[model samples]
Target: MSPLVIAGASRGVGLELARLARSGGRPVVALVRPGSDSSELRHLGVEVVAGDALSRADADRLFGSLPAGCDAVSTLSGLAGDGRRADDEGNINLVDAAAASGLTGRFLLITSIGCGEMAPYRSERAIAAFGAAVDAKTRAEEHLRGSGLAWTILRPGGLRTAPATGNGILSADPEMHGFINRADVAQLALRALRDPSTRDQAFAVVDRAEARSVNAIDPHPLLALGA
Candidate 1:
């Protein structure tokens, strides 16, 4: 695999994904915000580029050097009160800029389960709490889907800060909902990126148990989780 360009690699699932890629002997170009510490990434030999995912100029600068048809994954998001637009503006900038760069391969996007058609399955309270973020994610998904780039959108259930259980699972059943470890999410992103069958598809993911790794529990490497 060529160097994978990951947006939102400063921390959390994005960071873990970068680690996995590096561990697998794949080069990583991690995009993070300016001023954000990249010590962890640098420690892993990742090439960290500081840029706001919501800035067109920044996005252009990052993607301009990316090779055409290289894999990219974005997990950009803002917290509840950070006053930053993440799910929407953040991802849109990366998507649009990458598309324009003509170097984007299969782009995998990570979003929450309540986004898009899965909204109805969420409780009213949950929706009310995350409604704004969900709305923004939906719009970003729409833009990516319509951007004419090969893309796969993953709407994972609640994310947890636990260690990998490897029991992560994926389903097209929008009604299916649960929580997953950030590491499991990263594993799924790796599988999906290499699977051509997942192109232009979207699905919900969650962990069924805390005993196995996502890839280990579901070993069919070519998009068999939700098949």
Candidate 2:
């Protein structure tokens, strides 16, 4: 299989996904910001490419040279720091570059629940604190949907630092909300990458016990990972 290229692998869901992919014996490459410490990613045997996803030139360089048929995943976000959110321009550039590369494999984007149709379900306070991020991610989601590449968008609910509970699941419902372990989300993402049935679909992901609804569009991938 072509290497799975992951952007924002310096930490959080992206780092966890890189760990899982390497553990599964899949070749991995990580695109992280310049000057960010990438010791962990390098330790995982991932080819660590130091580049800011926020730069269109950097994004283009990374995606343009990928081997044909390579899959990609992006967990880029700008919620924690200053300046423009990679959640918008960064993701858009990546999507555009991927489309330009003529890649035939899937491109998976890991966004969040407050985006798109689930916006109404977010608490007012939460929105007050993160409204800008939500909007940036929403724009990123829109760009990917129109990119023409085979793509899957996983909008994970509130993220948790807890270990994977094996209860995380994907729901087609627009109003689903809950907290899920980042590890579980990573597992689900890998499953989505391998399952062609999930292509061109955006699903809300959360732990079953915490979710308000259980209208999972596909049961197979959820159960495939022992969920």
Each prediction's whole-model lDDT (CA): 0.82, 0.86
Candidate 1 residue-wise lDDT, 78-163, digit = tens: 85356768789888888888889996588889998888887777789887898888888998999999988899998878888878
> What does the lDDT come to for candidate 2?
0.86
Best by lDDT: 2
Q: For model 2, how many clashes?
A: 0
Q: Which RMSD values do the candidates have, in order?
A: 4.4, 2.4
Steric clash pairs (candidate 1): 165-212, 166-212, 166-213, 166-214, 167-212
Name the top TM-score candidate: 2
TM-score of 2: 0.92
TM values, all candidates: 0.90, 0.92
